[model samples]
Target: MSEVLESTTTELTPGVRVPLIGLGTWPMAGEEAAAAVSRAIANGYRHIDTAENYGNEEDVGEGIRRSGIARQDIFITTKFNRDWHSREGVLTAFERSAHRLGVDYLDLFLVHWPNPAQGRFVEACEGLRQLADDGAIRAWGVSNFKPAHLRHVLDAGLTVPVNQVQVDPARGQPDQLAFHRQHGITTGAYSPLGRNGDFMASPAITGPARELGRTPGQIVLRWHVQQGRIATPKSASDARQRQNLDVFGFELTQEQLAAINALETGGPPRLDSDTFGH
Candidate 1:
């Protein structure tokens, strides 16, 4: 069963392929988080996302070790927060994340959020590029960055390969996705399920789930994959983790996809990089 229902992958760069469905390790920590990682790997997830703010890097590392999978066989992504937005601070914080994750080279590293108010994200992008060049990280990207932030990075003469952010059926980010496509940046979604319980009640999501004999969460994730974004939906529950990873088996039709797209309400307490935080 595992052999037939394997996970799909996306290549961010030459020789760097990440599984499209990753186990997002946020708000999960300690031994509990470690167990989820191990379960995810055993269930066939090769990509895992972590962050300095998540405070679960060590546990994620422990899970990898427990899985008995070679470190090279897994793709690890860890992010640094705004506190490390400075040029020097970037590398320093990266080293700390690496040390905690117990790895020397990361498959993906990102600036967790664009600290627009600080005005030093460009420097952080350079720092990530240096880390990639130095063989410390295989690929580098940014998260939660708007078009302006992306443009700022590009104007500095660098075009990143990936941008992870909060994208779901509700907040599809159509304009931002178009901008990323024009620039050749792959968009990765964070809150791909748009929260949890209250989110699943939407008729747009439930209708597809019932018709396809899949869970609403699976329907949503399939939507992300079909539209060509790396979807990282976090779940500490082993059952839910495997359930989310099992989305590759089905495909959504054009009309069905459009129906789901029509569910966007445009109100979710937006977090704009331009005026969010420093």
Candidate 2:
């Protein structure tokens, strides 16, 4: 309901700007996915995150068409599936995604996973660089990568503009975040609300939510934005999507932020390649 959430953007890297709070379209697809995206945009979401594996790019594109927002106004992102790491596979995969999304160029493109077992990371990174050179994607990044993997990209001379990972009130990634900040790389959080239940139930989030007179989701998202990381929350429900974007009106005091930061116990990350069969 706050207007602030509807109108905020963050410069992730030079020439790369994204809505600080975005709608994540993971499991939703088809007409349902399209409708949800359209509704979210109408309600004031300017960034949308999707992946080829999600099977919803076309639907997302349809929604964008319906939203009446200019193509230049929305920051759209999609990813290259790990299985498509071969040189040819990467190009073909992204082209397919772009075609389905009905967009000539993506605001950002990412390597979905490291897939070290496949031994195609360098090749994939090269392919991404080629795409960038050709202007097929405005920016390139990765998801679920550790410091070492990121360093490999850097050493290889691939300037990754952003890295999307899972960060929330319960699972804070301090070391990874510090590494990114040192390198001038932006971080994007996928489950910014800690997959919903965990975030809503955490004392770290609840205490702040109650003290600030805001929802736990808002508190968690504000934490990410205040930390300078981009946060994308997934929800098909219109009201919930709007609530996820309502993070800009309040400011977490330094003490409140520290309280949340202190909750970071260097806990185990909830996401791993094993879980996703990468």
Candidate 3:
């Protein structure tokens, strides 16, 4: 059995300590998803990220069971769809997701998208708060929320623990990250590595990879955790899974970090939450 890596965590709430790095399960389903989760756990990962929209919660749950790790030993995060953007609807979504994941409670639950057109995300946030207050979940957050959406949530006097977004070296979302910091909201990065291997070829990333003798992906994940952000990087290959978790052992120089940070293209994120929804 592989030794489990010691977790480095960031506080999402007063008492909630979320691992700095996690496993992302998206665009994978069925037995393949299950096996990946199982392999990840055996290789030292304690964080697993999934969503209802991904349609693989059952498989992820099966993988957890196969790993023989106690439920409490792992941190699980899942997101709900827009159709459930209501006080009661969010509760219903939680019930269904918990049932599918075979877990009595969740570590963190996020409103998948704002779906601002529906005008009920606030109520959905209300539902999430109730769940968190009642111990149904450790914490609740939003995904794909722009500054405007988060501002609305805050204006309502609601506190957001985290905001999950697509962030990579190529599209760093500096403005979004700055807002999160100002609001004391933890930034959870999805797709932390840019869409393809193309971005990894940049000298900014490659230089560090070569100097440290680590793969470009490892360098990137290291850059993420070094900044105190939470990243969920998905990989089904056992070797990749192990490699992802192995990022904790090294440090990146400020110059190298800045070089990679400079890779941001200043382009709009791939999906605009304003007009996009499940």
Best by TM-score: 3
TM-score of 1: 0.93
lDDT of 3 by residue, 180-265 (tens): 99999999999998788477999988888999999999999998989988999999999999888888878999998999889888
Clashes of each: 0, 0, 0
The local distance difference test score of model 2 is 0.83
Stretches of candidate 1 off by over 4 Å are 1-7, 197-199, 268-270
Q: Rank the candidates by TM-score, best first.
A: 3, 1, 2
**Residue-by-residue lDDT tens digits, candidate 2, 81-158:** 877787677789788999999988888888888877777776888888788878888878888888988888899887
For candidate 2, the clash count comes to 0
How far in Å is the alpha carbon of 61 misplaced in model 3? 0.6
Clashing pairs in 1: none
Model 3, global lDDT: 0.92
User: What TM-score would every model get versus the actual structure?
Assistant: 0.93, 0.91, 0.97
